[model samples]
Target: MAATEQEESLDDLPPSAKLVFKVLEYNGPLTQKGIAEETMLSARTVRYALERLEGISLVTEDVYFADARQNLYQLTEPAEEFTASDGEEATCAD
Candidate 1:
């Protein structure tokens, strides 16, 4: 989807999901447990937040090589997508 669409989708999500997204954006890929710890949210809440993010295609899940039993979550867009030629990062609401 377009960036505008993504922004709109993100706006529609609950605050918990938005927090989770921001945490991932700043911390890079992490396991569900890591997300919960970073956000200070419960595991169940983090799971729901991840679900919402995945539903919007904003997040992707992959096997965590270090632990096959767990999965790593990360933003779909690379860091470069949020960076301009001049090296400024895009705002979340932009």
Candidate 2:
């Protein structure tokens, strides 16, 4: 898909979700706390946004260790398509 088209798809997301996407886009995989810290969002807010993004297949959660309570999140293809270029960083604006 074209960059413009991909970007348009992301336009529907809320600011918090877009912020989470941006943080992941630039910093690689991060745990929910990491996202919250980077975005200055509450942990609960970050988790809520991540859950919404996950439902739309824009983000993925992977359990790094069975004993760990939190999972790391990475952007899915659609997210990368819109928010990254050739693995280079991209920014999302509110």
> Which tens-of-lDDT digit does each residue in 1-94 have in candidate 2?
5664455445677899999999999999999888999999998889888877886678899995843887989987755546676777787777
lDDT of 1 by residue, 1-94 (tens): 5776556688899999999999999999999999999999999999999998998889999999999999999999766667777867666663
Candidate 1 — number of clashing residue pairs?
0
* Candidate 2 lDDT score at position 58: 80
In order of appearance, the predictions have TM-scores of 0.74, 0.68
Q: lDDT of each prediction vs. the true structure?
A: 0.92, 0.83
Tell how far residue 70 is off in model 1, in angstroms: 0.3
Worst 10 residues of 1 by lDDT: 85-94
